[model samples]
Target chain A: MRGLGTRTVLYQQNVAASLGLYNNDLKSVDILRETGPITAGELSKITGLATGSVTALIDRLEKVGYVRRANDPNDRRRVILVPEYEYKEEVGNTYRPLHQSMHELASSYTDEDLDLITQFIGKASAILEEQIKQLNVKKSKSSS
Target chain B: MRGLGTRTVLYQQNVAASLGLYNNDLKSVDILRETGPITAGELSKITGLATGSVTALIDRLEKVGYVRRANDPNDRRRVILVPEYEYKEEVGNTYRPLHQSMHELASSYTDEDLDLITQFIGKASAILEEQIKQLNVKKSKSSS
Candidate 1:
């Protein structure tokens, strides 16, 4: 449990540091990076953040010039978020050290070991997400 | 780059969501989780956060009862951080989802594909970290 927790924390910190952004700022960047040009409403739903929070996140991101909100061409009522510029180069540069360390670490492992670790991490992540969803549902049900 | 960024963001978000902690809060949690009962100074060095920043972070974690500061048994001048009782359970739940997801995703991939992606990510992360370090060194040199 501690190991998983540590991994999760490092993963976030490393990613955020690499992007030259804080954690909250990274959320918007992440949504745009993954889903691409998503509506604020959709972002709120997908991220499970409050609408107000999403709006504020978008506001901060826009202020930093990392993101822009444009009206969806097909749906004028919807505003879609996009990255101000492609972040590939900047982000790629940020993770170089961790990647190098991982390479060295992996080199010490056999193929089976690497596979087992990867599989373990992946499964663990999915279970965490599912549990979170269940927790959220329980909270909502109790509140209602 | 996109794949790396997305994966990194997801990993962080999943972990944070599990602990019911935010990204910034998770930094301290992660350090404590990894090194176990470390001094604030050690955390600052390991996290690359300013000492002042680490202090504030520790304050927040302490307020939440997630972590505590104890006088070092060997060195009275230093304070060591210890996780509270629930920390393990909290951390354990965080990785459960990720592990499940990895198991499913891995089944779809050939061993070679997994190796390739892992190697690519490893190389890319190293390159990125190196670039950032170089930039930091350049800045420090210029300032001096």
Candidate 2:
């Protein structure tokens, strides 16, 4: 049971550290990872991060050669973000070891067990997010 | 498949944000979460972070009322770190929504499909880690 939590943390830390980025950096990555070539404003909206913060984040990632901004052909005011293909490959390569370890670990568990864990993690994440939202609501109401 | 990755990122972000901590800050919480109370030195070893860094982390956590350090009566030089009881409730309460969601999601997936997805992710994570490790080794060797 405890191994479950540790594995989750290790998985996260290993992925972020391998990419030489912080968790927030990964959040930015996720926005791009899920939807390819999005504008900065779009990413900001999706992530709920400020435009200024997104700019800084994009700057940092660009400096590291992980991402780049291109002028939107249709809209001059908008700049689209495209992950550097080479960078994605680089990041993907870095994840190979962890991926292999996870595969081996999963092999030990039955399909039923794997399904249980997946559903468990998925539901658990949703529950956690809802609770956080509720707490924020409570805090706001209290302050008001 | 993509949804799983997104879910993982969401959980990672929620965990970080709820704790008001970043990647490095959560290292201690991770240690405590996985192994319960542990000696500072042991934590340093497990985390691969410097002892000084661990000590500083402990200090910051102590200042924030998140963790407490206790002297080991048998070993005066050793300090054991424990998470405050409040954190247990906080973590559990925060994760409740996620757990419930996961339970529902599990019910939707066939045991075989869940196994396949879990296996895939597990393999992917291991492969990624291995690739990164090899890259690091190559970099080190080249530099030398």
Candidate 3:
């Protein structure tokens, strides 16, 4: 489990380096890509980055053409940060080999094996999300 | 799988925030703890951080009492970084509940189920590592 976690991080670090971006920046791009257009404030809240820091992150991403900022259609006062979905091609290509390998590995397992694996992973992921939520609540409380 | 990866990153980020350290700094401590006493240069090599950046990282970690720097006895010119393993208590306590929960989750499964899960995780981790190595190689080549 520990090895899996460490390698997961190392993989992102390498990918970030190859793209000439900080790990946080690359991660922000990912979040944007996953969530579609969202306000900078929402991004700050989700990422736990301060207002200034989140702005800087957006600036970096925008400069690289990975993201764009536009006015919210319903609210003139709000700015929506848009992910340039096309940017995924570069990042996706880098991950293709690992995806292929993982796909091959899963195909080799029986249905029962996959079901068990999926159950474990699903439970484990929930536990992680729970812990993260608890920590975030604690942090916000303390900061408040 | 992607949720697991993102959550893993968030878990570490929250832990780092709670510990008053950068995510990268906390991860550096993890590596130092795992690898034992290693020189700054060795850390630089392992993390792919520039020497000056790593020096700053060591300084931040040392300031917070999570790391110590010592001169190698056999080679006076080398400075060895020793993690204050005692610091793990604070970090460990935060993770203890999750660890306990995961232990229970695992114990609920049969040995066969555990075996299959382990095998799958091991193979997936290797693929991630292999992809990381390829990225690192590609990065170094481009930089050179």
lDDT scores of the candidates, listed in order: 0.63, 0.64, 0.83
Off by over 4 Å in 3: A70-79, B70-79
For residues B34-109, write the lDDT of model 3, one tens digit per residue.
7899999988776767789899999999988889999988899988999995566788887787789889999998
Each prediction's DockQ against the real complex: 0.19, 0.28, 0.65
Q: In candidate 1, what are the lDDT values of residues B29-103, reduced to their tens digit?
A: 755665678888877755556679888888888887889999999999887999773456756665555566656
lDDT of prediction 3: 0.83
Candidate 2 has a TM-score of: 0.69
Write the residue-wise lDDT of candidate 2 on A117-143 in tens digits: 666556655554464455445445655
Interface RMSD per candidate (angstroms): 6.8, 5.7, 1.5
Instruction: Please provide, for model 3 over A111-144, each residue's C-alpha lDDT reduced to its tens digit, 9 standing for 90 to 100.
Output: 9788888888889988987887788788889999
What is the Cα-based lDDT of residue B124 in candidate 1? 43
Per-prediction TM-score, please? 0.65, 0.69, 0.86
- Candidate 3, residue A112: CA error in Å? 2.9
lDDT of 2 by residue, B1-144 (tens): 234444454555546656566546665675676577889887775554558988898898888777899987778887889877345666666656666666676668788766665655555544544544455455456558
List ranges where model 2 is wrong by over 4 Å: A1-6, A74-76, A85-89, A102-144, B1-6, B85-90, B103-144
Count of clashes, each model: 32, 43, 0
Worst 10 residues of 1 chain A by lDDT: A1-10
The model with the greater lDDT, 2 or 3, is 3
